[model samples]
Target: MGRELVIGDIHGSYKAVKQILERAAVTATDRLIFLGDYVDGWGQSPEVIDYLLQLKSQFDCVFIRGNHDDLLLRWLKTGEYTEEWFNHGGRLTMEHYERLPADKRQLHILFLESLQDYYLDDDNRLFVHAGFTSLNGVKHEFFTRMFFWDRTLWETALCLDKSIGHNDPLYPKRFTHYKEIFIGHTPVTRIGETVPVQKANIWNVDTGAAFKGPLTIMDTGTKEYWQSDPVHELYPDEKGRN
Candidate 1:
């Protein structure tokens, strides 16, 4: 038996990813569930993907799609680099791809294309890159983009009145759908925390590796975790997504 590790948004910090995984002493038996945002932000966006591809060959891994990933996929397929995407870390990712051969770029495209919108485990824990909007649950989510772009679900969990019992009519139906939810998008650093935050039944593991924080990986079962040194420290010259 091995641990089930849920990793937060990477945002192209390959150095951070390597550091955290080694620090965690991850093995082939330990299942790695990545919460996405693997690219953009840092200068190593392309390198991150290469490392992830390599990891899949040696370990059990689950990849989730994110908003930045969707933007990257669209850019790869159409060569349409929008201003909004460029301003938000896409520029770094795009520039990296410029040096790659066509075959390597295609491989990245396939990997990105195959990412899941959400993953549900036997334990009934939900893993999504962002949040789902469906009251019934992820399977019934109306918009595909909501799985990677919606912040309302996290906001609802963060703002919910803890005094409201689970059975109360005032309780949000979305909260009742899973045993626990794990996500990464809006970083916990936004709330002044550099660690995973649990609000209601949701665990936010994104510790702001895209900017000044570190990349984190949590053992979903034990809730024990390991974090890389602050990403900015590892890549001191890069502006990252700051």
Candidate 2:
């Protein structure tokens, strides 16, 4: 078996995605776990999805679904749009899809719809687009929303990392089940870091490719990582969801 790599959000920055993949020297034997948010933000959503699909054919890959990807899937299925999604980079995704041929668009939609909410590897590491609420194993009937929208789990993990409120009896026990957890919805850039941030056993790898930071990918076993150049520089003419 090859090394296991967990990647941060791509957010339509195909250039950054390409950069990280090349930098990591990903091989066909490597297991590539993408933390989601493959679309929106940048102008290359279609290209990004295409590349991911192509990458899937070449490597062992796990694709998780992010909130932005959920919105895109919903729009594809129902022709509905949420103002919030649009404001959060949905418009660019729509524009990219709209320009694609109908069959190609349908294929892309199917790919997005097939994404997993979370993935638990054999090593007990959990990969999710966003953190989950339950510390117990993620339930089959758990609300899909929590898979891509929960933040309190990260907060609790942060608290645990700082040894703050560890004595609080009410703290959730679910987080302790995994050997380590990797997530991407909440960007590390918000915390002034362009690299992966580890709070307790939870690793936040979304280094804000949607804005000004680099795209990140890490080796699950080694904790070693690689990042693209500042993503904004890769697409100099675009605003990129800012």
Candidate 3:
């Protein structure tokens, strides 16, 4: 059986991506579940996409859509963008992509279009860019945007009392729906930890590769993990959405 490795947000740090994958010794037989935010932050957005696309050809990979990814896709299709998006990492992402040939640019857009909002494996393990809010579970979620934008699920998990048993009526239902829930989107760095965090049944893999933290790849089975050096150190020349 192949190992399932859930990855944290890349945020365009292709260097960190490479480092962690190499350190993890990921084989073609392993399943790589990316939690998205592949772009936006570092200057290597285009490079990261290209690397992921190549990796897809070589291994079992699941790509989940992220808010920044959706934002970039919208601009790529319509050329309309909010000022907030531009200020945040869109401007830098655009600068690199502008150098892409039209055909290559379209390929990147198509890759983004093909991303999943969430994936449930045969084990009922749920992998998503962000958390879902529906009490019944992800399929019951009404807004696709919430898959990559919602923070409530993580917040609720954080607030969960460790003493609350699984059978407790007060236990979170959304968590009860799956054997394990893995997510990115919100950085664990926010809580001052530079590693993956486990709250309730949810594992937050996002170690803040977009800021000063390292990119992470964790084995879902063993919970063993590997990390690249801080993303900022990989690209000493860039501020990386800091």
Clashing pairs in 3: none
lDDT of 1 by residue, 38-135 (tens): 99999998899999999999999999998998999999999987898899999878888988999999999999999999999889999999998889
- Candidate 1's clash total is 0
Q: After superposition on all CA atoms, what RMSD does each candidate show versus the true structure?
A: 0.8, 1.9, 0.7
- Please report, as a residue range, the 10-residue window in candidate 2 with the lowest summed lDDT: 161-170
lDDT of 2 at 86: 89
Model 3: runs farther than 4 Å from truth? none
Quote model 1's TM-score: 0.98
lDDT score for residue 150 of model 1: 96
How many steric clashes does model 2 contain? 3
- lDDT at 116, model 2: 97
TM-score of each: 0.98, 0.95, 0.98
Q: After TM-score superposition, what is the CA distance of residue 203 in candidate 1 from its true location, in Å?
A: 0.4
**In model 3, which range of ten residues has the least summed lDDT?**
1-10
Model 2, residue 171: C-alpha shift (Å): 6.1
Query: Candidate 2: where is the Cα deviation over 4 Å?
Result: 164-171
Residue pairs in steric clash, candidate 1?
none
